[model samples]
Target: MILNFFDQFCIPNLLGVPLIILALFFPLMTWFTTNRLIQNRYSTVQSSFLIYITKQMMLPINITGHKWANTLITLMLMLMLLNTLGLLPYTFTPTTQLSMNMALAMPAWLMTVLTGLRNQPTASLGHLLPEGTPILLIPMLILIETASLLIRPIALGVRLTANLTAGHLLIQLTSTAVLALMNTMTATAMMTLVVLILLSCLEMAVALIQAYVFVLLLTLYLQENI
Candidate 1:
């Protein structure tokens, strides 16, 4: 039963080759292109959203970190599209995979750390120790801080994976219950259907929010370094 519940998360295959690669790139197809001089509604909305999100994300970053603006925005959009599209029937969500999430998290976190180390070594290293520390507790504090620093990427990945996974499981369970009750308990099934709809909407919001959070954390890490 447990295996059945988790089976949906497994990487889909075609002729023994993983379809996750296709899943990863599928979102790109949904992106709006602005090739025409007179933009259509889709292109206009896409450009406006990009501009707004870019402004918001750049507001907190310093000039030195502005170079990361494009990378961060592109990542956020990719994640948002992947997560949103995953909610569709017969689609896979790469973000729900821990390995994929960690792959995204680790590089972003490492880049921030490296930026800090390269640009401001003393300040970055200073983060490992708080000011006015007791002499005896200094060593212990340094160890704790070091542990926390190293755990950032893991935390980022786990948070995204857990949230999306839990939401997907809930939606699945609710949907299954609705289907099971439709014949025997019409009224109850209707109620369950309504709940399922609500859950779907909430999940969509979570999908976007989690992607934003992932990038926001990366931005904060960069801010600390820069």
Candidate 2:
């Protein structure tokens, strides 16, 4: 039973070919276009929103870090699309996998760390020790800080995975309950269906918010380095 519940998170395959690749590919194809002469309402709104988000994200970091603006913005959009798409029936969400999330998190985190080390080595190293540290506690404090620094990427990956996994499980359980009760208890099934609908809406919001948060945290880390 437990394994069945987690099967949803597994990389689904059809005739030995993973669907995750197609899942990612289709979304990217839809998100980009070659048209330059026309603009629709949807495209206009998307452009405006992207511009606003880009400005907000770039506000904290120095001009030196502004170069990262495009990369971060594109990443946030991809994540948002992947997350939103996952809520649909018969779709696989690549972001829900820990390996993928960690792959995204670790490289971003490492880049910021490397940037700091390259641009401001003394300041980056100094982060391990506070200015007014007690002589005896210096070693302990350094170790603790070092541990915390190394754990940032792990925390980022775990946070995204746990939130999405919990939400998906809850939705699945509620939906199963609704299906099971439809024949035996019509009224209860109707109520469960309504709850399921509301839960789906909330999950949609959570999906977008998590994507924004992932990029926002990366920007914050970049701010520290720049």
Top TM-score model: 2
Root-mean-square deviation of every model: 2.3, 2.0
Q: Which regions in candidate 1 have their CA more than 4 angstroms from the true location?
A: 1-3, 13-36
Across residues 1-226, which tens digit of lDDT does each residue of candidate 2 receive?
4437677777678888887777777755865753645788877887899999899888888899999998999899888987776686666667788999999999999999999999999999999999999999999999999999999999889888888888888998998899889999999999999999999999999998999899989998888887
Which parts of model 2 are misplaced by more than 4 Å? 1-3, 28-34
The lDDT, on a scale of 0 to 1, for candidate 1 is 0.88
What is the clash count for each candidate, in the order shown? 0, 0
**Deviation (Å) of 128 in candidate 1:** 0.8
RMSD of 2: 2.0
Across residues 1-226, which tens digit of lDDT does each residue of candidate 1 receive?
3438777787778887777667666545654443557778977897899999888888878888889989999999889977876686556787899999999999989999999999999999999999999999999999999999999999999999999999999998998899889999999999999999999999999999999899988999899999
TM values, all candidates: 0.91, 0.92
Poorest stretch of ten by lDDT in candidate 1: 26-35
